[model samples]
Target: MFFAVIPAGGSGTRLWPLSRAGHPKFLHPLTGTDASLLQATVERVAPLASADRTMVVTGVAHVTAVARQLAGLPEENILVEPSPRDSCAAIALAAAVIAVREPDAVMGSFAADHLIVDPNRWVETVRQAIVGAEQGLLMTVGITPTRAETGYGYLQCGPLIDGGPLRRVEEFKEKPAADIAEAYVRSGRYLWNASMFVWRVDVFMAELARQQPELHAGVTAIAAAWNTPEREDVLGTVWPTLTKISVDYAVMEGAAEAGRVATVPGDFGWNDIGDFHTLGEVLPADSSGNVVLGGEGTEKPGALLWDTANLVVVPYSNRLVAALGVRDLIVVDTPDALMICPRDRAQDVKKLVDELKSRGEEGYV
Candidate 1:
């Protein structure tokens, strides 16, 4: 059997204004539908498992929103985190939950805000990962890079597996500089790290025990208390104290050291939808190369844009915005805040968010 878990605990400050407190990006309608990212993620994983087999691990703050967005999923499948621990602890909690349910089931972990357009290819790739997991291999799905993007992690591809299309992972690299990213794109030897992982319950738990003993203790407690009232209370207490670490840093890196990690190059039209820069790539644009989202006056509604080219206007409301003699600029307006910056500087919006937070302007966010 196959099970899927989604981790949705991050505060998406990169997409500020629209993504505010108590409402993260996963709940935002980024796909031009009523379906949020969490909904889309659930739909993508639903075909791989039974209704009860899918789980969503998120923080307590967003539990209500998560519930409302994913009403199609079972209420018990929602695992609420009591505090802000990182991905390693979240994955441990998921593993413990699944271990109690199915002692030897194969499971896959994904993020709630990823965009995979081709469902058929995604299902096939997941099946391939499950096969790899049953053989006791920790599998990670990597995307073939289409551009020289320095924003994502990369994986060095090794030789192909003996009987399958999957490849052994030679190494993992963090986000690199522009030149290095371009060189990687030219070499065709690396794939963007999608953070998609698959492993069997027993294999995953054993690897956790070996590499992360402290986290292993937390997992042990949760597994021991499964189906009992103590599971939630004990996990709430122990999980917050867990070391904040990435699963890649804690498990995959060590697994690579032990020569047990593998990679499957999956081209399912994957996108993390992480930032505005990436969102622009997926959204529609005018002839002027402008991409707008989640608001009106997208292209100067009932107005004009004379002598303007390559401008993105994302108004928060139906307010009319007129632009003249502007090019390569992003104008995002909300009721509480308005942002106008060159498209090239869009990636640095995080710095602006930090400044806003330092100034105690939480309402703007």
Candidate 2:
């Protein structure tokens, strides 16, 4: 059996303006759907884990909203952290809780803010990854790169394992330069690292202990007090002591080096929504190549375009947004802020968020 866990906590600074500290992008309907991204993520895994068995690890700030969005899930299943401790701590906390209930349970960790167009194929990919989990191998679902993407890390795949779809992960490569990303796609042996992981509860804990003992210990202590009255006291005391790092640097990369990691190629359409440009790709576009994300709290500003090609407009506010003679631009409109940048500079949004904090304009961040 599989128990799904969603680490529903990220500032999503890249998708800022629309994605804010109060209401992140994961709480928004970025996929041109009525359901929010977090709801879609859980519904996608309903067959694998029911509401009782499923869990969500989120920050204390987002706990209320996370619970409101996932009303079907048990309130106790929402593991609230004292503060942001990165993916390693978030996932470790969920793994520890699952380990307490079902020592041999297989668990899959999915981000709260990603999109997969082909849900059925995604289920199949996870099912295959579960096969790898049963073998005590840490597995990640790697998306087949459709193009040269410099934003995502690449997984160098080795030979097949046990004559199955699973392949030994030769190495975990970080996000590469444009030329290197292109070469990786052309080599026919690389897949975009989507950060989707699956493993038995005990197996993942064992690997986590081997690679990040301190993190393992902290989460274990928190989980021990999870259901008790000391839950808040223990979490507030221990969570901040854990190292702040991503699972990639803390575990996945090292496990791959030990030949205990594997990758399952995912043919399903997947999008990390890293920036406005990527969000534009999955959205419906007009003949002029202008995509507008409107409606649902955001009135249709009715973006007018002339000779514009590849424009991503997020009209979050009621104000009218108009563009003319623009090409490959990203225009995000919020109630308090409006951000305009070239499509290529989509990654710079995070810098803008940092600059806002540096200038003490955290009210906008």
Candidate 3:
């Protein structure tokens, strides 16, 4: 049996108003379904990993909400971080804790906010990854790129290992420029780096010791005291001293360069839903290509659109939002804030959150 580790840390500033610091995107049901993203994620992996074997690493502020959402999971399974330290620390902490219990356990780290349309295919792909992980290969599931998406990173794949589905990861590329993204898609040699990883706890800890010794040491110390009364004291003392970095930068990139990483190509429909534009593309749309969310169960319709093409409106306040003759626009109406921007400019929504912080408008943000 394999363990599932979910690193649910991001505040999702890019999806502001709907996703706030107090209530992040993972807590909201952006998908048409009623289940929140984090809950959906746990359910998706339930077939492979039972609730007892799954672990969630989240911040102190959101621990209560996370526990409430995942009520079936044991309280100890919900790992809490005192503060934000990025993916490397969060994932490493979980890995260390699992290592203490079972050193050779095969664990997969998945993001809480990503959506996989085809759960069966996703499970099969992860099964393949687990097979590779058991062979001592650090496995990462790479999505087969459907379009020239500049928002996600890319993984350059080499020849298939042992003449099979598993391929050697040649390089890990950051989010490329428009031309480079287009070129990558056209080449068909690159896969979107979805940050999905699988490996044995011992293997991952060995790699962590080799690549990021300081981070490995810090997490190891915390894990030692995780079940003891000194858990909080150890986490508070050592977490801040650990280097803050993403797992991609601190481990995967270097491991790939050293030919220690392998990837399984997954064609299952996957979307990170990083911004409104991406969410609109994935959600159901009307005949005029308009996507409406929220206010559905209420007395009034969530949105009323006429002659609106490719518009995304999210009226969370249960107020009817009526738009006429609007094309390629995004309207997000919350109780305290209303954001109007072109659909193409959805990626820039984080700028609005930053502006609110600069203006000392924390309530709105």
Better of 1 and 2 by lDDT: 2
How would you encode candidate 3's per-residue C-alpha lDDT over 1-365 as one tens digit per residue? 69999999788888988999999999888877778889989998999899989999999889999999999999989998888999999999999999999888999999999988888999999999999999999999999999998888999999999997999999999999999999999998999999999999899899999999999999999999998999989988999999999999999999999998999999988999889998998888888888886524556457778788999888888687999998999999888899999998998999999999999999988
1 or 3, greater by TM-score: 3
- What is the TM-score of each predicted model, taking all chains together? 0.90, 0.92, 0.95
Order of quality (TM-score): 3, 2, 1
Q: Which ten residues in a row have the lowest lDDT in candidate 2?
A: 294-303
The deviation in Å at residue 330 for candidate 3 is: 1.2
Q: Residue 81 in model 2: shift from native, Å?
A: 0.8
Tell me the alpha-carbon RMSD of every candidate.
2.9, 2.3, 1.7
Candidate 3, residue 158: the lDDT equals: 96
lDDT of 2 by residue, 1-365 (tens): 78999999876899988899988988987877667889999999997889987889998788899999999999888888888989999999999998888899999999999998989999999999999999999999999999998878999999999796999998999989999999999999999999999999898899899999999999999999988999889988998899999998899999999989998999989998889988999888889788888655544655777788999997767777878788999998888999999999998999999999999998999
Which lDDT tens digits does candidate 1 get at residues 1-365?
88899998776776766677767888876764546788888888888987699999999899999988887789988988888778988888889889888899889999998877787899899888888899999999989999998889999878889965888887888999999999998998899999999999789889999999989888778768867978778876787779889999998888877878888888888877766666777767677776656534233243356778777666555576778898888776666777777778777777788888899987676
Stretches of candidate 3 exceeding 4 Å from the true structure: 295-301
Runs in model 1 deviating more than 4 A are 294-309, 318-325
lDDT of each: 0.82, 0.90, 0.92
TM-score of 1: 0.90
